[model samples]
Target: MKNLARTARWLLTLAWQADRARLLKAIVLLTLGYLATPGIALALGAFTDNLLDGRLGATFVIGVLIALVLVAELMMGHFAHLYYYEVGELAESRINSELIRYVNGTPGVEHLDNAKFADTVTLVREEIQKARAYIEALLQVVLLGGQLILTTVILASLEPWLLLLPLGALPPVIMGRYAQRSIDRSRDAAVEQNRLARHLLHVATSSSSAKEARILGAEAALKRRHERSWREATAKLWRGQLAGAALRALGQVTFAAAVCATVYLVLLQAVRGLVTVGDVVLVITLAVQVNAQVAAALSVLSTLHAAGHTLRRLDSLKTWPTREPRTPAAVRPVPARLRHGIRLEAVSFSYPGSDRPVLREVDLDLPAGRTVALVGENGAGKSTLVKLLCGLYEPTAGRILVDGVDLREMPPEEWRSAISTLFQDFARLEFTLRENVGVGDLARMGNDDVLTDVLGRAGAEPIVRRVPGGLDGALGHGYTDGAELSGGQWQTLGLARSALRDQPLMLVLDEPAAALDAAAEHATFEQYAGSAGEVGSNGGVTLFVSHRFSTVRMADRIVVLEGGRVAEIGDHAELLASRGLYADLFELQARSYS
Candidate 1:
């Protein structure tokens, strides 16, 4: 009962916030409509009794009153619907906006790794889509309560024994609560499978994967998997629906039996001459209204229960702690320039929901203003290390120090603002070319001179010349006149975006040139290496990861990682002379090109 009250308050608050004037108007209309039910019955009974006695004047007045009540009973609810419908739509939009802000404004990305969080988000999204139905159910429940009260009073006035008719509604209310619980459980259990089915459907129909599916001849296989998942989800829901229907039928049967007994008692009273004909008519009509009210109550309660469940999930999501909350007073400011390099001491990390550490305890330093290259096999934690440097995740053990200060002491947003990065898997935003590249530094996005300079530095001038509107042209295939560039061209644009951050304290490029040709890759690396002095002047560090030995040799120092541990660190000439793991790998790669 407490939970019900809380949910009712929450729903009312949402409606009030959406549109106060409309909500008031709707309430007024709905009240008049629902209360008119009992009024109509009373007027009809009075009119019947008057006509039977042949009182022409009283009969005419009573007949007119009955007609007026009937019109209000039929017309008011429909008019109320127009106002509430708009209220529901506006409430839904507000909730959706809140959801978007919560998901995007979180400080860390760790919560995104949990599958349960994803499922809850999916459910909340689905529930908010039914906002219209929820609002309607809420209003009906309110009006119906008043109607039921008026009905009980009329029944009791005719005969005190008829008051027992309203009690019959209890069984159905109980059954409805139990039925809703079963349905909720079924939906929870089927959420994962339903999500999988949706993913499969998207894959089957998406244009991006069309060519690959045709080439691999996997269309039939995808179809079969989608059908299987959809069937499983559908079967679970159907079972729940069947169980709920059966329970509701049983409850309604009990109520129906009670209604017949009440009517019979009223008829017996009339035969006994204990009550007038008008009393008999009023009792019979009120009994029928009680039965209808109980059924409507069950439906309204079901919708409210479902909406309450959704609200609880949303509340949980809002309170989830994604990262340790820090106060501004506790956070240190980022240094304007790096006087010393970054140091990693005994640092290690493991991803969420995993026991195995991706990066084992290791020590390293990147001196201010020098270029450093990282080389390793696929699972050597190169990308993880880069993410750490960018403050995406905190280390599970030990700490990272920047210029003699603990990295954790500085604000994450401030620290990240001082860094620039270009990863192999980068976003291809389907917007204007300028917008795509300008997102790197929003403050300077509209400065054409800055954009042109960055594009030239990244060797993307040829792409700019090819596109119809240069920086202003739309990009990607989403637009009618959009230009879709080759993979290498897109990578060049990503580089240009990264370059927009001028003199960042840390510049990280993780396989940034993988899509470019051998000559282009070499030229790009040479240009960056030549500009190392300018980057180093402000004590900035330029760290890059590459597979090509030719580009790796250009860095001032190289670090070799193996099995999640640092194996070697030296300049190219020194490593070749030491003839360690680095030399063997370089020699092997050189032979491949020979």
Candidate 2:
């Protein structure tokens, strides 16, 4: 109950914040319409009595007045719908914006890929239009109740027994509530299935997956799986619909019987001369309209219940499980300069939902103004270590320290602001070349001189000379006449983007030259190392990962990682003299070159 109240409060607040004027206009018009409904039956009765009494003038006036009332009702209804549409559009925009901000703002990318979160978001989005009118739904129910009351009063005035209209209307509302519960249960399962089916269809059709799918001859298999998913999902929903139909049929039978009983009782009253012919006509008209009004009011409840499922989803979005936010006590002011250096003491980590650790206990120090290279075969935890340094993930067992303070004592945002990174899977953003390079460091993004120097350092000068628009050309095939680069060219642009941050405290390059030829790779890494070492007194530490031993030899120190442990750490000559894993790997590469 408390949760429902909280959700209602949230939706009400969201609606008011989105647009108040339009909301007020719609509700007022709708109320007036509801207030005018019972009056129409009264007007009809008045017209009948005047004619029966042989007062033709009175009859004519009432007839004209009835026509005017109907026209007024029609006008109010028209304006109400118009205002609802406007309010709906604005509310959808506001809701989507807020949802995106909160979801993306949560620390890290884990929850973004969570299936439950995806399902909830998709369902809420599908019902987005109805969800926006939460406050209006409450107001509608109240106004509908008012219409029912006014309708009951008329039926009672003719004969006290006519109040049975409400009782007869009760069964349909009860049955509808049952149907909605079944639908809600079925809908949850259906939504999950639908998402999976849609994903299969996308994988089969999307260009990114086409090569692999065709190579594996899985196109027909994918189609069959999608069809099965669709059939299963729809089948459950169809059963719910079947149940609802059954309920509606039972309700309709009771409704028809109520109408027959009301007619019989009114005729008996007329034979006894207890009520006039006008009163009989009024009772019959009020009964039908009143029944319709009850159904309308109940239908609002059914709609609200349907929308309530989506409202719950919206609430879940706000409560998604996430990494704990840094507490005030845990945050310490970062120093203006790197003091002793950054150290990882007994650090170990495991990804979420995994039992095995990716990185084991290991101690390493990156002194100020030094270049450190990390080299390891696949799954040796080199990239994981870099992720830890970049604050993308925290160690599960031990912690890292900056100078002498715990790294956690500084805020993650502060830590990130002082560093730049180029990951192996660097994003090929579908933007202009300038935007792609400048996006790495937004503060200096507009400075063309900074972009030029960074591009030179990244060996992207050749790419610039090849393109007609130079830095201004659109950088991907997704845009009109966009310039698509070779893999090496894309790597060059990525390196330039990372280098745009003029003086980050730390620079991490994870295979930054993976696609470059041997000579180009050597030149890029030399520039990266030399430039990082020139930061003077507060020079940042540069860390890079590479499989090429020739390039790795350029680092001031090389750390060889093996099976999630640092197996050897020394300069190129020292590690070679030690005759360990690093020496063997280096010798193997040298032989290939010879």
Scored by CA lDDT, what does every candidate get? 0.87, 0.82
At residue 376, candidate 2 shows an lDDT of 86
* lDDT of model 2, residue 499: 88
Which tens-of-lDDT digit does each residue in 1-594 have in candidate 2?
A: 354455556656766777888878988898888777788888888899999999999999999988988998889878987886677678788878867876777646656557778788888777776754555565666688788888888888787888886788878777877777887888887998888898999899877697799999999999999999999999989998888778866876787788789989998999999988887878888888867876776677667677677667776888887778888988887766776778999999887667898889979988878899999889999988998888777788898888778987788778888888999988888788889999998888888899999998787888888876987878767756788788788888999999887677889999998888888889878888866678364668899899999998989999999999999999999999999999999999999999
lDDT, candidate 2, residue 356?
92
Q: What would the per-residue lDDT of candidate 1 be over residues 1-594, giving only the tens digit for each residue?
A: 676777788888998999989989999999999988898789878877887898989999988888888887778888899999989999899889877876766656666777888898999999999887888899999889999998988888777887788888888888888899889888998999999999988888887786688789999999999999999999999888888888888889989989999989988989999987987788778877888888898998999999899788878788876777777777888888888889999999888888899899979999887889999888999988998888887888989999988888898889989999998687777788899899999999999999999999899989889877989988888765688788898889999998898788898889989999778888887777644357346678888898888888989989998878898999999999999888999999999999
**Per-candidate clash tally:** 0, 0
State how far residue 86 of model 2 sits from its true place (Å): 2.6
Off by over 4 Å in 1: 47-75, 275-281, 327-329, 459-474, 477-490, 526-537, 584-594
How displaced is residue 32 in candidate 1, in Å?
3.1
